[model samples]
Target: MWHLITAPILLPMFTALLIMLPPIHYSPNRRRWVSMVSSAIQLVLVVLLLLQVQQQGQLHYAIGNWQAPFGIILVADTLSVVLVCLTSFLALGAICYGSAGEDEKGSFFHPLFQFQVMGINGAFLTGDLFNLFVFFEVLLIASYALLIHAGGKNKTKAAVHYVVLNLTGSAIFLIALAVLYGTTGTLNIADMAQKVAQLPASDLMLVKSGALMLMIVFALKAAVLPLQFWLPATYASASAPVAALFAVMTKIGVYALLRVYTTIFGSEAGALSGIAADWLLPAGLATIALGAIGVMASQDFRKLVANLVLLSVGTLVSLVALQTQQAAAAALYYTVHSTLVTAALFLIADLIANQRGKAADRLVSGRKVVQPVLLGMMFMVGALSVAGLPPLSGFVGKVMLLQSVTDPDNRLWLWSLVLLSSLVVIVGLSRAGSTLFWRISGSDTVAETAKPLQVFAVCWLLLASPLLVIFAGPLTELSLQAAAQLYDTNTAVQLILGQEVTP
Candidate 1:
């Protein structure tokens, strides 16, 4: 049963290798079956792992039978396992959508897709900071290839920008890791948490610098404020499924911040306590402002959805910045809602674009979709969710976030910004919906109907919105438990380090 901790990472990796082998490599049908089956199994394993975490506290697996701070380790707690499950579930929808026909647009699409899942899963599961970096590279490399799949000039340009920015971030990440390793003498996060507590006064500045640098890297990944310029064009240019999966990619940054800060630099860390919250809250607010502007200004549907992703990032970061159990619970719930909602919008945008003929996804009056009734309904649900309207998970998440903040200053800032930004999103999406569906012009001819599998994929992801609302009680309870686990650094240290290490 302990071996299940590594299955999420290993399954996709082996599936990717299998997809690249002779029989499956040549048969597209075979590749699709393999990818889809692998993703399903991965999802099931992670769910079971989540159940285990609920039954048994935090679980750890020492690779090669070596313990933490000595060899590789994988740890599964509530937070990490939930995220791993989300990754696999999302990947299943994406791969199912691609199998409809998008996989044929490029070589090794199945393999690259499997590898990307592997990297994402590994990133969520690994206990070592260095292994996290390795997983980041793996995912980034696969994304580089996936971004340019069925290459076009605009995609090429976007890929170039994405590659350059992440490469720079990777460099900074490496430098930060070096400094932390030098100062703390360990890269295992649990062990680092132990070491960071007992650091000498003289080395405090260096450790602080390293920690902030790592935050900067994560901020870049999260697309927070000033560093977010690259995301709009890049996401808008990728294929639908790729963009959908990339939704979870951004959340990885938020996850890292929540995990690292709460575990290692919580109130127990003396002068360095809550080091990220001050910078993050303001940055998150600014990001919301920026995203609102982008959503209104966007002329392309995909680009509009991309900006919405930015808006969700802002919301999640701000909730995390609050650093309370309630806030953390809200952040977790919102993370799930936002990721699925945005991914659905991307897939929905692609559906509209495919059906709009020459106008594509541009925000202009054109022919209505052949199945306007179906697509319009889906778009409405997605738009309402994105706007944080009632009867959907988005509304629930926003309410949770609003109720979580107690500080007058934080409430003023968060309430004002979140509400105002949501208003802007509603207006932007309203304009988009009218233009795409209601304001029909030109020829009555619509493009070919969307593939059934594609529609199914969109429906699958979007279904989470209503389901989340229905199961809010149990889900939010799990989130609260996850949050409590994160802040209880002492229990975490003992579980992972296998010895009493004072927090």
Candidate 2:
């Protein structure tokens, strides 16, 4: 069963290949079934893997039996598995929603979706920096295609910006890898962590530069500060399911920052300890302020939600920058909450757009939707949740984040920024909700009712908000355990280096 560690990465890959073959590729129904079944199976595998990690600590797999610091290695710790599981769950909702004719809009949608999933799971599981880079490219390539899957002028424009920016990030990622490899003499993360601790004074500056360069790439991915301009247009214009899947894409960068910094440049590494620490807090605050403003200014509902993604990124980065185990746990909880809510909102936006005729998600007065109460209720739930209102998972997450900050300065900055931003978000969303639902034009035509499958997918993801609140106990415990595992860099290095970890 240890080999199941490879299943998350391998399942989607083989599924994609299978999907690209003659019958499945040509037949939309067949392709949809194949993709849906594959995603469901992947989710099951991920749950089993998560359970195994909870019971077994961390699981390690070496490609071709080559150990760490030599050949490819994959490690499934609590943190990595939790992320992989999230990706799988989100992917399932996306594909299920897409099955209602969204997948038929382009060639190879199912295959690309599978490959995207493959890349995300691989990124989460890989134990080497270069492999992580490879996985990044894989996901980006798949996303480039999916972004323009429905083939619109807006999508094309957004795709161009998305592609160019990510290609630049990829170049930076490569350069960082080269510098780190040259400095540490290995790409294996655990090995590099050990090497970073022993580096000479001369190479210290070079390693530091590489590490900082790495943070830039991750910050861009996380949509932080000046690097965040790409996300709003890109996410707002993509097809709904594609946009939903892209929600987790940003978290990859956050995951990288947390993993790489906490391990390689951790406190044990002299002079380079907490290299990105000073930069994270200020950048996070700026990002929050910017995102809140964007949410208020957005004319399009989808764009507003896109900006909410940015706000969540800012909240997460700020929490992670605290570098406490409690903060990490809170960030993880928020990660799950924010990703699910944002994705659900995107789907809801698409549903509303379909119902609003030509006004179509523009946050303008338009014809009443075919199903006002259902869509309105969903929008309200998503908006309240996104704004971090109480009695929901979003509220729980933000409260956890707020409670985790013990330092007076941090508390002042975090509480003020998060609260003010949440207020801005609420005001923005309230305007949007009222405009879309209440200020309707007296038009005779109504859009086709939402498909059952699409509604089901939206409901499935939206359920996460309440369910997260109800199950906050287990989930928060899991997050805390994951956080603890992440901060135990010494044990991680030892385990990856093939040494026994003593209790």
Candidate 3:
């Protein structure tokens, strides 16, 4: 159990290697089965890790048992443990779905998928800035390959854009790392936090520049405001399971932002405190508006789902900018809800495309689906959930977010934009759903049906939202506990700095 911290990262890595055996001539089913087993193993590991964090407080594992500032380490706090568990659950759903013939489109899909999981888990667990960059690169490379897995001209073109944009962002990330190391003489996050706390107002500007650059890089990955242009085209054009898996990717940026700020540049820091919140508010509002516009203007379902993903990011960023512990907890809650919802929506898009034949998820009517009643119901639930309607996790998350923003300075503005955005989301989804489902012109042609496995995959994701709602009390309590830990950075600093602290 003490060695289980490595399980989440290593399981997927070893599975990926096994998947790449050239002489095995792995069949599609075999690959899917392997991926499923690997993901199940990861899911169990992460769940146990989450329990360890809760019971043991925080768990640390250093590579090769090298101590302190020299060796690589993995830290699992409440926040990171939650994220890893969510990532593995979604990966499992994606593996189950991808196995339904989509993985057959590219020979390397399963291996890349496993690598992608490894990267995501590593990113969440890494204790140093440099390792975070390495994990980012690993995930980005796998995503690039996965995007073009089915081999479409449009997808290839979009993958090119994705690669180019991320490469540029990576360069910026490296520059920021160099600047921070030059200024503070450390890349370990807790070490840097100590240095930043001691940094004077006069000497802080250089480090501030580096922090801003880090923010920009994260924003690019999060698709925040102006940096978001690359996501829709890339995600919308990709295969369904690939797109579904990418759903968790943006949340990684949000996680990085929260992690870095709380540990290094948060309220505990002198000049860097409130820096991100100051800018994130306006930019996040703008992003919500931008995503709403994209949703309305979208001609197809894939693009619409992509826009919804962006909108969710904006919502969380804006709430995060409120800069309170409750806000942080609310953001965490919504992050889980939105990730599950986004993944389900993406899978639904692909499922609906099959049943619609030439209608193919377009706004226009072409043919009726064999399972319109079921699919339509699922879409409505997703839409209502995303729009923050009642009796769902989204509604609970939104209410908590609103409650968290009781700061008299910005409560009205927060309420106004959030409500207005919800209205836009509802109207836009209503129009699109009616157009896609109600205006169907009947065709005599038999519609192609989605695989039973694919349907199960979608159902798995769809049910998570309701489960979140069912367990909202415990989940909210957990998120609040996680938020308290983040705000209580001293305990984290002690652990990360290798001081003798209780587990």
Candidate 4:
């Protein structure tokens, strides 16, 4: 049980170190094998942790057996565990996709990939705010290296933009943390939540300001609307598998907002109670509108998928702002749905580009791709899944979100945006697909081809959304259970404080 809690973080950390050792310094192939084995082992560990949370119902492991509030702690709640599992699944497919020469694009691609996973896993498990910042920086540094891995002019510019924006966000994150710590004298989340109510009146304003600033940092990470200007180029500029792995990176921000806001603030946040409610919904709606427009304007497959990521973030944040358990559950299910399909879409775009030869994923009528029937088929499913078309988990996730927000105030507003944006996505995807597949007239020209393992990786990811549909009932229940754990403020606070934990 303890091993389940620590393995995801520890395995990847050691794997990265092992890859760096002089013995393996010369062999990229060996490095890749090491990373793949580590990813597989992490996936198994994540699943085991998820199962443990299911049986034990929200577990916590204080590092070195030190009690919380004094030492670092790792939590295994339903929400954290579910995200760990999602991260591992994406890592596996993305690593496999990269294995087919994507890792060879840079000097330390395999090692950087391991550190990225380690940071993501650490973010999901850490029970304190300071560690969150540390992990965020770890992943950001790794990703910056990754963004410009193949040394593109465009990727370099995008990395500059990404680095500048995230560096600003990180500085702000520290200020917010300082404020929270100054007010409450503890950086531990559970302790802060418990101590918030007891803060002197003089410190209340600073706490509220800190909380608001924290959300701003998270929004920057999630890339919603105005803050989203940094995302499109950054994602579109990366090599395929790095971009695919990144599909889950923005989601880490979403996960933070979901976990922290609900857990730390909740209904009892006092002046902070409705901190995000007022503007978040409206901002989220604007993000959806803007992303839909971006999708329509996009001239290439990479850009289209990039905007789809923003669109997905908009939809999730809008529903999340509703502040209901139902919304959390829907958001969780949708998170899984979106991450898998987004990865598939990125890899599919790269694969399609390979097949299209001179056409090369441009949204124009050009030469046909050689032997791309399966690739085209995968793209269609992926696009539908992104557009929230029926029977797939994407549709089910949206329905769950809709069902959650049936109140008069949000119902009409959310429904209109969801349905309307989805239609716009459908049209944009249809236009892109039609121009690429149907409008083209000539035979393949360049004849570039995708590796079998790369195709298998893409297919493996594409299958997750449909499989979610097959297991929708059980999965939704698990999501609801996770959301319940998230909302159960007392249970978490008590568990982390080393008080007798609730079942």
lDDT of each: 0.91, 0.91, 0.87, 0.87
- TM-score, candidate 1, is 0.99
- Best TM-score goes to which candidate? 1
User: Per-residue lDDT of 1-503 in model 4, one digit per residue for the tens?
Assistant: 66679898889889989999977767877887888888988898889888888888888888888888988888889888888899999988999989889888787888888889989989999999999999999999999898999897999999999999999999999999999988889988888777775667888899989988998999999998789999999999999989998999888888888777776776756656667777679888999899989999999989999999999999888877888999999999999999899889999888878777676888977777776587779888998898899878789998998899968978988899989999999999999888877877676486757787798889889889889999999999998998898888887887778553221
Better of 1 and 2 by TM-score: 1
Against the true structure, candidate 4 has what lDDT? Answer: 0.87
Give all TM-scores, in the order shown. Answer: 0.99, 0.98, 0.97, 0.97
lDDT of 1 by residue, 48-80 (tens): 999999999899999999998888989899999
Clashes of each: 0, 0, 0, 0
Residue-wise C-alpha lDDT for candidate 2, range 289-406, written one tens digit per residue: 9999999999999999999999999988888788889999999999999999999999999999998889999988898888999998899888888889988898999999999999
* Candidate 2 error regions (>4 Å): 499-503
Judge candidate 3 at residue 466 and give its lDDT.
90
State the local distance difference test value for candidate 2. Answer: 0.91
What's the TM for model 2?
A: 0.98
* Error in Å for residue 416 of model 2: 0.2
Question: How much does each candidate deviate from the true structure in C-alpha RMSD?
Answer: 0.9, 1.5, 2.0, 1.9
Decoy 3 TM-score against native:
0.97
Task: Tell me how many residue pairs clash in candidate 1.
Answer: 0
List clashing residue pairs in candidate 4. Answer: none
